[model samples]
Target: MHFQFDDRLNSFRQEVRDFVAANLPAHIVNRQRHKSFAPDDLHTAEWQAILHKNGWSVPGWPLEYGGTGWSPLQQFVFNDECAAADAPVFPWGPRDMVGPIIYTFGSDYLKETFLPMIREGRHYWCQGFSEPGSGSDLASLRTTAVRQGDSYIVNGQKIWTSGAAVAKWGFFLVKTDTSGKPQQGISFLIIDMSTPGISVRPIQQMDGDDHLCEVFLDNVAVPVEHLVGEEGKGWTYAKDLLDHERTGSSYIFWNKRELAKAREIASSETIDGIAVIDSEPFRSRLARIEAQLTALEWSVLRMLADEQTPWHPSALASCLKVRGAQLQQSITDLQMQAMGRKSLRFIAPQQMADFPVSTLWPDYLVGKTSVALITRAATIYGGTLQIQRTIIAKMAFGV
Candidate 1:
């Protein structure tokens, strides 16, 4: 029932800030300051390694699994400090998302092999849950894995898989039985990206990044040991993984930092003759966003504080995801407003990749347009806004 950070949590937050200031490369911080959609693979690797060395890589996990054993509030503090310090986005799938599912449900062999790799950031892992026809309707996924002795032959196509083009491993949901209900026949399996029958074609996003991909699995053989939990139980596991994903989708950290950036941009620029920050309309918008952000911050804290509140965790997550996705776009739109015509100075992904921050416009302007455009997809990716609304209706209200 404590509403404020204890001294221990306060000290931990300061340590995180100090460590980030001391260890994160200057260039990495600069890209982050400019609101880069995602840090390049190189920076992600190096920063994760530094965090691992300091025993702070996976703050939300249990200590036995190489986590910091920090309380939920401390984890929040760490996330907040990292965002404020402009640190690279943490690797979620490998460290938090699938990692938990693996430890809690995976075999000892799966744990022994993957946990160390994840903890050390050795290989990147991507989610393979959303097939072309089965995004929010995940149980309709057509990917099939037919068991044959020691391995299963997997065949299907998965679209919108982030980092699939470069990831080494994937956690997937494949149909193991079609006789049962739609949600009853699925199985969770981990497939190697290097498997011979696997092919990954990058999908060029409107924001100009080729990270999202279409993965075709043609008779790809996966070891049976890679299956998580048991056959005909993947629906449960996928639900668990997604529940964790939706909680983080609230995006408290991103919202907080972007709101600050909007304020910064407003204060620095002028509208007509006065500063944008000084204009009444601009001030009003900022106030509204800040108010919403504050309410969201409290909602997240409340859910994190006690999972057994009146609302089910999934229902709470849906509520947060809906509001959070909306706020993400709104903040970005306001940022676009703050940049004014400067937002129109579009920079190609290749240009940003080839040149240093200085070679382009000022640091603040480097990736503003790109992030703003990509934010338009925020509501679509993580169980779209409309879908989240439906979930809230079903879970929070009996209908």
Candidate 2:
């Protein structure tokens, strides 16, 4: 498939770049570039609101549903340019996950209620899938929504729910039938955060950030209309949502930005008073990573261009996610190695207040150790490295 952008797409990309450079808050970019972190809710809402105002937030959704109707290549270009510009990554719950699901399966009323708010940055969403014992194997989830007349009383727990603490709504999968087969008994439901028995408790990661959390639903009543797709067919809808998640998880834009950062550090750092970029071993590793990233980017483009009846193999998603996650870890490790002892020293959050302090490394490096520690779990979350390999074996290799 053609990965190169045509003239029109390039123009669109330049437009996006100009917009972000002109409008994205400097503080948000500082948090991303200097702190090596994702934006907080406040920053996310600020940037998202701006993008929504310009109709740039929903490029992948259909135009009727507030999308820009950019072609596949334009979409690719837009994302690449935005990431390269160090734009704050917008909240995904609204644009990436639930928006597409709603457009596809929602009733007109549901679409009217949610799509406008999603487009306007007025609502935030979280995915409620993982439970204590049911993360990877979602079919084993114990969360249940028992139908009682016009509403369903949900009672269960979800763990590792990213952004749940700050989310205003969530799309969840709950067991609605006990007698049917495990996968066949599920149903999808959307719950408002203000619902009576819902509570969110944050889970602090090794990075000292509270991005993930545990959500408890105790007799949380969701109206029957909130169901997506069909009753007892939630498993189907869940699979579709997950497929979307995996397809987008290729991490093309973010990895491209990160690879550029790695290259920048290599170009700047010296080893034994000699430039690290001149070292054969270091150059070889960087070269290999770039090549892999290039291949991964094209693979993503191919999938996007040919999104038709012959579904892209699920194993490819597993492969890209595994490699992308590992490459991120590898790049971070190489940066630390280059920094040497300088990376060992810690930078407390208090020091961040003193911006642009003359440090050997960037402020984000203050928490380099913390970031690296957290990235160690990259191969584990979303699904583990071993699980991805299993998928490759069973699906790709026809084991």
On lDDT, the candidate that comes out on top is 1
lDDT of 2 by residue, 48-122 (tens): 788888888788889888888787777778878878877767666777878888889888877998998888777
Worst 10 residues of 1 by lDDT: 353-362
Q: Write the per-residue lDDT of candidate 1 for residues 61-148, one digit (tens) a residue.
A: 7788888877777788888988788888775788878899998899999999998888878788888889988998888999999999
lDDT of 2: 0.78
Clashing residue pairs for model 2: none
**Cα-based RMSD of candidate 1:** 1.9
Residue 354 local lDDT, model 2: 59
Q: For model 2, what is the error of residue 191's alpha carbon versus the real structure, in angstroms, after optimal superposition?
A: 1.2
